[model samples]
Target: MAGLPVALAAAGALAYGTAFGLFGEDARTTAGAAAPAWAEEAADGFASVDALGQKGTYGGRGGPVVTVRTLADLEKYATAPGPHVIVVAGAIPVNPVGKEIKVASDKTIIGSGTSGHIVGGGFFLGPGVHNVIIRNLTIRDTYQGVWNDKDHDFDAVQMDGAHHVWIDHNDLRHMADGLIDSRKDTSYVTVSWNRLGNNNKTFGIGWTENTTADLTIHHNWFRETEQRNPSTDNAAHAHLYNNYLQDDPGTAVTSAYGNYARGRTAMVLENSYFQGLTNPVIKDATASLVQRGNVFSGTRGRNESGGTGFDPRRFYPYTLDAAADVPAIVTAGAGPRSALGTPRAAATRTLTVAKDGSGQFTSVQKAVDAVPAGNSSRVVIQVKPGTYREAVKVPSNKPHVTLQGMGASRKDTVLVEGRASGTPRPDGSGTYGTGGSATLAVEADDFQARNLTVANDFDEARNQHLTGHQAVALRTAADRVLLDALIISGDQDTLLLDTAAKDRPGRVRLTNSYVIGNVDFVFGRATAVIDRSVLTLKKRWDGTSAGYVTAPSTPAGRKGFLITRSTVNGDVTAGSFFLGRPWHAGGDATLDPQTTVRDSVLSAAVRPAPWTDMGGFSWKDDRFAEYRNTGPGAGPAGADRPHLTDAQAADQEIADWLGDWTPAAG
Candidate 1:
């Protein structure tokens, strides 16, 4: 909640006085015009609550929004660090067929329109992984040609010891195991608006004996699915509402039971319709179950109810549609919709770059070259996964240009160049110098790059004889720029945050990303906020342990670099790195540079005296400070080290650094 999400969330929290009102329209989970209405919506029901040391279900809400087509890309983003809104846009036939992709935390794997499909594979959420949303996709065909296959434990979506997840609007069927398996005491989950069919084990609630799982399942159509229409076992509170369960005649599959509560589970089933199903509702002797306003037609067997179950309204407010309108409503809106996850304007404003020549252009620069010089609208350059061995530059005139990597992980796509400050130009125009050594130079306003790795591999060890070693991975020379979910790696001066001199304005937001370097990696004069990202302190190429994370050269009172809710760690020598130092930039004493690292975790690699003097400019005179920093490297404030007061730190918030410019997903 560092950047635009905080403001968007407040506006969304009043939609309908219920859970629908909890999120704003701008708190979008999808991108493009083809995005479904619900795909843009946030989590509902139990998954929307903040409990069990986890935030509410905001799948990649504050991170980048990307579209994935291949299994490798899906797994990469699913397992990558930080939050990502992954839109599956094509039929990705699993390579190994039944392999279950282990998904990490803070992710949204959604389908693009009706075309997105996960064939013969599924997703798995392991222990401690939270804040996930899987919606509007077709996950099926892992049947192994066996109706009761016990060999393969394949499931469309499975979670073990995971919490705060929402599985909605999916069509899951024909899997080797349960389509949706919430096992090992997974808590705070909501299963809604999905269509589960053609499976033996449709859904299973528990594998653990502890009654700690909390769930809310609603607005789903369970058709021709056998048992465990989500059999709740050892669950603390299970609320099922407005669901349609039916088994018509001549169907190959038959319903065993609609909803079963067992092993000390407490369930409250309400406003559900069941047709031609046997044992629609059942409760074990050790479980507590209550059924209210349920419709069971042409169904025989145990329709039992007993003790009072836990109240769901005590958790989160929800409004349920009438039971009679469930089949009609779910029948039309259960699976993927037409508008969800599809490209609204793919024919325009998008350029494709691939090394394999599958895209419109073989090189990224060729695609950038295609844009008109004075282009005003935002144009996205979708670069496929490959090592682009070239430098890229976005001129200042080409504003609102986004270089997006078509990979699940940032490491999958690389824009690399081995250029250093001393690298000679082919035209014999002398050395490239510090400003020209950048691999990816963004000199345009409203520039953005995501799911990409921009690196300057200058080979310092092999090129030690070279005069200058300043290699910059990324450099921004414009304003309103966003580098989300990216990895910029180098040794010295890795990321230069700059402006068009002192008179011009520039602001960069680097969120949920990694900036790896040794000395002055994040040096610049621009007003930048590195929020919720990692600053990896790698050893210099010369094997030197000493380094500086930042070197800011801000003007008198304007904000410089503000690092918040980030981590500073690496496999470097302890007490060898300083947090930052003021940079007078050519010994200009008029510059009152400032850098503040607050609410972050610093490793022992950081020196106790984090701020040090440089070029006869004492850091004490500048604004090199830290506030409420933790970890082994953090130290007390002293004459050499500066710390911001609570009052002063409040003014340095991310909102303070970025005023009305809310950078969001394209």
Candidate 2:
């Protein structure tokens, strides 16, 4: 057994002796089992002066404390409201201790510090408790902490299925489910300023799920807590803000999905910090989202494939300056390399190499500058691999900008690397403020890149002082973009898939390709599908485990990322990856949800608890799903892993996203 605290041990013994003096051996033995010797003694000393029915007992009198020593005694006394404050200050036994004790409405529970703890094996709540507050306690090693089996109950605290409750300044660690939980229609709840760590080996809850509930999670530290299959129903409303999160080597923090129904809707997120781990966030949402002013500086150290991806434009809503001197746009035609080869049957148009002195430019951007807007057919840019070192952009008006390479052999074709500053021009001399270092920026609708490799080979490790230095390989905010046989590599948001259309849904297809990055490097809100592709996860030498493969910020009511028939391989562990999570609190649950990994292979580096929070919002109401994935990370399909039906896979409209191109395979 682990060592017990000295104070609790001494107090328990004294309390047992007092029981012997007051109610004979039966009470003494019960007291002995309830707490440590020291805790019993303290209880005895306090009990001598304390009475069961004192005038100030129920109110906040001189700690007119209601002390229940044993689990049995606690159970007996917890039925009615005898005191304003209840203290469970002992080492409860390891056996089945019945269920949770639902505190009376407006009651408070005071316990030991996070270090000072009690063991609640399986205690549950009674129905219809409201306005309860639980603080400064540690409940651990239990089946469910404060479970509410009843429906429509509100204003309770300290355990599973708590609704309209306030839980603050407590520590819940090493539980099989969630640290705090709620249930059906449970609403108007607030959970703040708590230390929630390592619990729930299974898919359970501490404070969770109110199908029609409204919850607020703020200023709490969720460290090393494991979460799975939180909620898929769109009716749950959640708000998360300004909290500290640390989970480096455990399961993810949150999970969301719409159950059979449309699922929970409405969510908001704001300023927070996450660190000390791999897979910091996720979003499986289908609702529109509004994300603002949050920094994901550290806490993303897994090279696992399906981890972190989202749109940077939505990260800090106020920081978007599109008119800034971003990278030069690449749109015109070059040599025979510019000729794009359509499938044997779908040849809509043939390429005409630009022989005019001014029409032919060395870099891809020069070509883009020459093209006219709104071309009907796709403009193919057949690139020959000698490293076209320049930043390129395809404007929204240009529409089609296809960079076709020699082939997939890697030796014949390569779209070398480069980036544009928020202020700098395409050449090395210019200075672009915020949006620089982007090798390729696509803002045009229906943009496609085949047989090309884009990279940002900037020396970030050279003390460049590039804090928000996004040396991106691609920043795409277009509708219907197709990347076939493409390769992207960089650090800190390498491939920004920004699909943030409020009304219409955009589409993206990444096929037979490879992408590598660090940090929230591959993040965005693109309704994308990565079919038969390879995600290569790279390691950072800084000893910081803070790089995820993907982070999707898919808001409510829009199409999100869909990854299928892919391979996730890297040097990281399975436990380091996050599948997806909600991006905003109280978000539209039926909006675009992040989905991936059907019929795929995820490396062992992907963590089992693959879902976590978006900003501060828990993803219990999002639509994140994975199906029939094989690898060391593969497990039986459960809440976290839902096998997609063949019909559902076909309906996702993946073919249209790949426009005018067919993958080598069926």
Cα deviation in Å at residue 426, candidate 1?
1.4
Top candidate when judged by lDDT against the true structure: 1
Q: TM-scores for all candidates? A: 0.52, 0.43
TM-score of 2: 0.43
Q: What ranges in model 1 sit over 4 Å off?
A: 1-348
Question: Model 2 segments beyond 4 Å from truth?
Answer: 1-359, 418-436, 541-546, 584-593, 638-666
Judge candidate 1 at residue 133 and give its lDDT: 92
User: In model 2, where is the ten-residue run with the lowest total lDDT?
Assistant: 15-24
Weakest 10 consecutive residues of candidate 1 by summed lDDT: 15-24
Model 1 TM-score is 0.52
Colliding pairs, model 1: 12-23, 12-24, 15-21, 34-339, 35-339, 35-340, 35-341, 36-340, 77-408
Against the true structure, what is every candidate's RMSD?
A: 19.9, 29.3
